[model samples]
Target: MAARDPGASVPVRAAVARQAVEWLVELQSGEAGDATRAAVQQWRAAHPEHERAWQHIAAVNARWRGAAVPSPLAHAVLLDTPAVPARPLPRRAAAKTVAALLCAGGGAWLAHQATPWREWRADARTGTGQRRTIVLADGSQVSLNSGSAVDVRFSAGERRLRLVSGDILVSTARDRAARPFIVATAEGELRPLGTRFAVRQHAGSSRVDVFEGAVAIRPRDAGQAPPRVLQAGQQARFSAAAVADTRPADGDSVAWADGMLVASGMRLADFLAELGRHRHGRLGCDAAVADLRVSGSYPLADTGRILDTLRATLPVEIHFITRYWVSVRPARR
Candidate 1:
């Protein structure tokens, strides 16, 4: 059985649990061949927690062996329906219903866990409060910011870096092979024309900031628009359908590569949100102080000290719910 850690985040636990449930479902479906079974054994052995989650899920399945539960009831539970039964279900029947609920809920959870699983399998990643630089085989350097993941693929024709999640600062090195360098996000692909630049992946869009030379932003959908070129000191955001207008880039866009967050008149809420990206757990600002402005070059390595500085200089107070959870509110007069 996998040893459970009390400190693991909900997302991490859910991801593991989902993987376990997926393995169980595949094996039980009677289609998993000998190789599939062997792979499952290897996976379970790879992590004790995987075995533990599987055992627990198996126990849940065992409870429904002899009882029948309505599919609608199971589906309702998976959807988090608020409707309640007028009369309580019988004990044996209730156990069967609960087991069905667990199976359906697990399937839904797996769908939500897909992205995190990809990040887990990323070729390169950085943890919270940590930054990493990987020198590619071609001598180009890619720096990953905290909580970032990227997959590097260098083929004979082109050098591609997939921004799986988070942000990266790329310094292009002249390739002796003369392969074109490109960075891809869900929204589009960025082709650097001998440039130093940064690419950040947001929820539904990707941002490109060019520090030197130029980059061509091409939307993933070919008919959306033509590729737009951004020169040095320019930044732009693009979605699958369209590219936004170019704006003047700022030092803060690439400052994380230097282990600092350079904010000039940034909103308190925005600052805290960016800081939270580098720190573990949750850090938020109350609406009362969210609009306040902040400016400075704060070290990303010391989030606590940065928060302390904010409290000292601004009209805001920091509240610690736990070491992992914090909020900033209007300072008490």
Candidate 2:
């Protein structure tokens, strides 16, 4: 099998590493289905890198086995007991303990890889803590917020984008072909009229904020009412049934494209929730401090640094249960 180039992009290398770890964990689980076995076989056959990665994992496992302890009691002790009372483990038992550690590590990696894997493979996407801009074939520009994904399709009559998840800011160019520019989300469709706008998709609704010109929002099932036209500085949210009342758009709405999260007297919980969109895993605050007001502009690129700034500026303490699990609480005097 040919080895993968060491200089491959970080995301590609990380994805392959996760796949290798997942395969190792599944095979060790002893309950891998026939389908799982077939999938792994297909994966190895599809790419030489897959076989190379599997070989590396196998070599690591062999090394662990060679240094393992002999006694089962020693394995249990090493796994469950504290290190202060160090005890020499038989070689066979130590091997089993190493294998168990490897399995646990693989399980943890799988948990971390679950959420953003789809976005990682999207046609156009931004990873957690990443923001990017893409220029379409027709000269239109789309800026993706962190953890966002969008699929673009240009046909003879229309320029369409499907918002699979997260948020995007679109600046429509004058289409020489005169194809209408449209963005579709689960909730509805947004048609831009020579406009610059932002669209965000939530669990049950989609929001459109027009920065310039106008956008026509049509609910997915507009039974009675006609499409709503939102002019510059207006924003509205809609579900499948109806469009909400238009509200004044805030400058903060498009600040994310500039890598800044701008907040003005926003609740601590709401601010954290928005910030979490650019991050991975769970990031919340204790209910006790949920109502506290926050006002600032923070860089979205480094969430850890943003958290550090919050801890320094606010009367809150940051608690990290794990790198993936974090919370903020009222600081103790």
Candidate 3:
């Protein structure tokens, strides 16, 4: 697509590592028009990492381009879902094509795009930037946030919902079986008291906010320790070991169910982390502005507009190397 990086010093990350391969696939397919070429030129100048990643992919792809299949790289990445060919890419060529992306420290992020059995096999799952609502057999409604998944199980004694990944909002339905409704995460289980609440599964802990009624937090490691009961208007996070102290619940916890993110005196880094969940790829805030306070009610569907909002109101600049790679830095003074 574009020439080598020449010489640029920047870590390849965000979508640069992934987008580079897609651009190469387009060029190698001999279908890229003049417009596509011009866009590639502009993308190369977007940031140093973009150039570096583009060059690296082209360089490595050259090594595997002459395999048994004539168009191995073209069909391998399936960049943003390119046109399907009459024939599928062979396993040998496909592996090498994916290997092209599994380079540098960014392999983890792109690798996530591959098969994630847990999320894929989940009974209910939402893709990046998407949400879903499913009605259970007992009429209970569960709402899944972006990049979320859940598995529903019912038994004679309990109505159980497992949070495989991401967050969920539960609206319990009175069951004819009269079973207690419970939600489980990696760290603990939540038993709702005929009320509506939101549960978020984090890396090391699980957070629950009681918007309507009380709930009990039972940590997996809480041997003789009784479950912590959280009343309405309270929130708590718990690990397998113990539950943290309760705090005043934020009404904004359920706002995502309505497609909005509400921030009130929230740190910029925290704000971006929440917003990033509704988006694909990376949305990072520089440490320099990490603690800056932000307050607003932003729509989840228009993440780009939210970034534009920060640029207009805060002392910040938004750098967009690609649609999938964006960063927020202090405004250049």
Candidate 4:
């Protein structure tokens, strides 16, 4: 072959690199079996560049599995591949360059592993005093407060999360055709009809609060009863029975995400209960002080400062049983 035009080979390499990346994704999902392997083999047999690309991907996989290959060396392998030819080569001889071609595509595959979508999602849990917000590929926003766990799944037909523990605030964005978003817990499945809501899972039950638009609640199995539609500002609890007995969500109820705990004339005990969920330890109030009125918005991010503020305002004493345990008792008159 006459001298190949260097620029003519660019698109060929680019196309091969793209195809290799897709293959890498498929392989990571555990779906590339015999037939897929055969297809890859055929591609490799057709071109040396294809074989190079596959080899690069294999090297990256080996590194991810704790092989001794370093990232710098892997990158070098990809960058060192020969330039593409101006004309397509004879198919059989192309296998010579497969390893070099794979190197060109492996970088992206390695980076994908660092992303949440590529990682094995679900079984994700947060420890006390920890919060995480994740953006799903489908454009959904999920904000998990302290001590929470939820499994996320998105398919072409549905977006779902099974809340195994703790709380999650989901703001579902409008899909191309406005698909429904559903969050399921032990209590039931809360389907947001293209709206934003928060699901809080407790020991024996779970709560759903709709902040925007409408949502529907149904049992997990969907055999017992029909789903109930909940409008904005409506809240419900799923326990022994689906209870619509809900109060208005004040500023305090939704302020914790912003580090504020808004308590609007709530009981001392109830306020403490709410605060305890956002902290790393336990908080309690003595029986005598349990009924004391709590009417201020405290900082959820800094529980210690909030407790100090409470001490200065209320006629109570803060007791520290341990770093993780605390209680309050009414001050003597």
| Model 1: lDDT of residue 320 | 79
- Model 2 lDDT per residue over 1-333, tens place: 443223222222444544554444343343444555555565556577666555444443443444443333222222312222134443333333444534433433334333233343457976567789999999999999876888888999999998977899999999998999989998889999999999998868999999999999999999767899999999999999899999997769779899899999999999998898777545768999999998999988788998998899899999875555579999999
TM-score of each: 0.69, 0.65, 0.70, 0.60
Ranking by lDDT: 3, 1, 2, 4
Is 1 or 2 the stronger prediction by lDDT? Answer: 1
**lDDT tens string, model 1, 169-204?**
999999998999989999989999999999999878
lDDT string for model 4 (1-333, tens) is 332222222233433543554343333333334544444445556577766655645554444434433333333233422223334333222222333333433444434222222112344655456677888777888888775667877788887788866677888888885666778787677778778888887656778888888888886555778788878888877774665676554434667677677887889999888787776434668999898888876766688988898899999989875545578998767
Q: Model 2: runs farther than 4 Å from truth? A: 1-121
Q: Which stretches of candidate 4 lie over 4 Å from their true place?
A: 1-123, 177-179, 221-224
Candidate 1 runs further than 4 Å off:
1-108
With candidate 2 superimposed using the best TM-score fit, by how many Å does residue 40's alpha carbon deviate from the native? 23
Candidate 4 similarity to native, TM-score: 0.60
Ranking by TM-score: 3, 1, 2, 4
Each candidate's root-mean-square deviation in Å?
Answer: 14.2, 14.6, 7.8, 19.4
